[model samples]
Target: MTNLKLHIDYPHDIPIDAFQWTPETTLEPFHTHTSLEIGCCISGSGVFYFEQKCYTVRPGDIFIVNQTELHIAQSDEVDPSTFIFINFDPSILLLEDEKLLLPYSYQSEKFQNHIPAETSLACQLQPRIMTIHEELSQQDVGYLSRARSILIDISVLLLRNYIGSISSEQWRRMNHSYRELRQMLEFVHRHFGSNIQLADVAQTVGWSQARTSRLFREYTGKSLRDYLAQLRLSEVKKRLVTTDDLIANICFDCGFQSMASFYRAFHANTGTSPKEYREMNGLSEDFEKLGDANEKSK
Candidate 1:
């Protein structure tokens, strides 16, 4: 039996993005902006897809997903799942004078060292995550400044403790595969809403169509076409939640050829029609509340 479920809602207004997700099955296909995201699993077991590897995550486990990684969360066992995600653009913490105080820069190769595994620093850094969340939720005047300070502290701790010790050989092996896969992923994100073919993606990544397809499947455990479709569907859902666009307009914007196809894909992926999903997830009320809150906060 398949118990696939999906939900898409923006839960916070602060630019230091945060959200809580509880999924009975798998999260919908989605990508984030150029921001660093760290997630901790509060309960249940699952695999997090990122950087061409699927890392098995359990309760108390924390993982980092670097900027621009295409990712999804799926529960492996038939149990409820819950997690908290904290995301922030690196610029939030890096002032000109304080640039050195911030941890590894994403622009440099150093940021890539923190993917998929729990480094010694990540272990030490895990406990403070709760404190950061609490400060953000308080949403006081100086909370953003406090959060930024905590974030940079965490990054410095991770770099000094874990990233500083990697050998050159190990770094090369990791970088080789990660660099290629990242190139392919960038292509997928750019062309997912168009009439993209596997050959087209292969050409963009400098691989043969067959080899590229095999590599993508091996890395992600899903066909490239299926991944692209899901990406498109996710965009459609986001638009439905955040805007008052017509269904037909959203369909075309998300690369669906017709309304029937759009409806079928939407229902199949999300277990509800687009309209139903939006209403059930509190799109109208939540958006209004969020806007008012933002205005007040400002």
Candidate 2:
């Protein structure tokens, strides 16, 4: 089975997405998703549910749900809550500030999910979230970069606000874990489009499979299987736009042996059929044919 998390339909090449959410919004309930999510409550009231606790969300409240946590939300029937949510892969932070990974790597039980209304941190984050929403909606030139920049700013605020909670030893451990994870990711990328098992990854990092699996989730916010599937999905997309190979061929070349499984995984992650995704991001069929004809004339 394809180990895909809920909210698999993140954009190609863009690692972040911001959108409006209401009580009526559809989502897989209590799934441990692969993206770090930060949400700002805009209006009404709601409760965010975790296995052990519930947080009542109100306007100006900022909630952080780390990628590994199983969580869900619902609003009061009388006045449904509305929110602006920004969900992103943690890998995006590596380019800007790898240390920003600190906030999301928090211990779930000790961490405070809800930043209450009156906190200046909440006030600080709301505008940045709004700016991200605008950049995403408008999609102006450099919007992708701009939105990521804003997200980094938000991360900084969160780090500053939560600094007291993280101990010096934990900070040291995070840096060390990041180094180990970097090695593991590089190994996986080198062997992408091949069958990679937990044992394979464990050997690369010189750790037991159990240790590798646990730390991989802590460091990357994804299981080994899901991470590999995502890598294959990314490669499939690159081939889709850059090459005109048959979809089945491209998929099989990427180690997706089953067409049905590959198609389902592609559509689930990209929110488009493979052909549609190609058409949207690459040259049209007529253009391709015209280029081919030009080539023939030569």
Candidate 3:
């Protein structure tokens, strides 16, 4: 299956990020991130658009998204879904187990992306995940260490229950494939802000244009152009929220060839114009902070 190439530059200070939210009434655009994400449905029902299929999600249902796996979430608007998400770098788990879970996680056939409530493991995992959420929210002095411990326990459980060991050759193949994928993703990140094309990416990775395009689509589940558009949109979104740049300027700065295309693409991908998005996020006050600080300096 083609996976979406999602890049998340996580903050160094905190290697893991966790949160719970009731998705506001809309279908999230196709997206991916660098952190491996574990999600549990807290209430209501929803569907996760993943791996070119839809997986129904209900209360207590658990889903896993590997780093750079393209996916989207849509709640049943009438019922609405609340879900808790825990996103962490695999390296963070190695603090306890130096080897990490890489070996087990690579066992493709045994590893699963979704676990329904009917499963025995899911029954056991729901409560533990909730407890971890509680520990994080309360932040009772040693909560950070406590939270990490719980996370490690969860990782171990998943490895034991769902993953299987691979043979030497299989392990070597999977490792090499994933390393190449990461390099391709890094190339996309480095050049997305410029006039990067599929041909350019293919040449950079030492492949024919046709071969590169096909592989990119197969692995990412989206076209190279579409991924580039999403990447540009993300940058535009960031600039909209954090800076006072003009909309047209932000569009060009992020690599859109013209304002007409930018507006069309932004609205199609985000469901809102750039002006409306800024207002919806309520970041104008955040943008004003710089001016306020400057005035105080005077």
Candidate 4:
């Protein structure tokens, strides 16, 4: 029942991945993974939602998403954008002090989720990001080594110029809450698809159920039930696009007990039926396969 969205399996060899996206891409749900993500808006425009904040993203905009933060991006349909995302494990790089960089740091007031293109920091990182993307795309002879070198440079840039420091008093005050919240998140991530309740999460984190409810809302701005539902719905959406499983099967596999419930939740989240969503995303091959599976099940 572990939610796949929260737990990521980094590759053993490189521990880095590069992604290119175009206008035709659909938006993924608000989710988190363990890898630190760095991205650049290569062309056009979009909006990036990080935690509860929204930032307008255009060409040259470089952003970072830490492992624990929930985020998503949507392209403007009229002037659709292209983006390049680089995700890497910090353990892959040699560092004097990894925590100074926001993405690698777990506790710091200076941690940043993104930088706008207008900022000087973004200006400095843009060319390096472009070079990384080029190296990844063309995959020249020493591309992997070159990419890692660039990543170290980017880390140094953030640590020296961009990241902020917090006083000891502030860190002590925030660290406990942050640790508890992260523990709760990890619990929910591992058991969201099961019959997990507030009491379970509360007990796991050694907080009262009422306090757990209040703190989760304060931290994430969503109720526990609502957040769990979002996780389930996100999984369903992923299967709808990538799997040939029947709708009913997917519904159950994603932890929805009934087809009606899954349908209602999916529509509420995406403003479209699951079938319609699959078709619109050019996943009709899987959609048709799902139909075949459904017929066989019937």
Top-scoring candidate (lDDT) = 2
lDDT of 2 by residue, 22-82 (tens): 9753433566676788999999986887656789989999999887777787887788899
Clashing pairs in 1: none
Q: What lDDT is obtained when candidate 2 is compared to the true structure?
A: 0.82
Model 2: runs farther than 4 Å from truth? Answer: 1-15, 24-32, 46-56, 68-74, 94-98, 135-143, 190-200, 214-226, 232-280, 283-298
How would you encode candidate 1's per-residue C-alpha lDDT over 8-111 as one tens digit per residue?
22233223656677754645564543456677777777776653556677776776665444566778667665777777644333321222222333332243
Ranking by TM-score: 2, 3, 4, 1
Tell me the lDDT of model 1 at 57: 70
**Local accuracy of candidate 4 as per-residue lDDT tens digits, 1-298:** 1223564443212556677876444666777775677888989987887666777878888878776666778888888788888877544442323233343544423455667788888988888887877887787767878888888888888766643455566555555556667778777877866768889999987999999998776444457897678778767777887877788887887678778888888887788998888777645576679989999999
Model 1 residue runs over 4 Å out of place are: 1-123, 128-165, 286-298
Q: Residue-wise lDDT of candidate 3 within 229-273, one digit each (tens)?
A: 867887888788777789988988789998899999989867899
- Record all residue pairs in model 2 with backbone atoms less than 3 Å apart, i.e. clashing: none
Name the lDDT value of residue 201 in candidate 3. Answer: 84
lDDT of 1 at 227: 64
CA lDDT of every candidate: 0.63, 0.82, 0.71, 0.71
Give the lowest summed-lDDT range of ten residues in model 4.
Answer: 94-103
User: TM-score of every model?
Assistant: 0.49, 0.67, 0.52, 0.51
Which candidate, 1 or 2, has the higher TM-score?
2
Q: Is candidate 2 or candidate 4 better by lDDT?
A: 2
Clashes of each: 0, 0, 6, 0
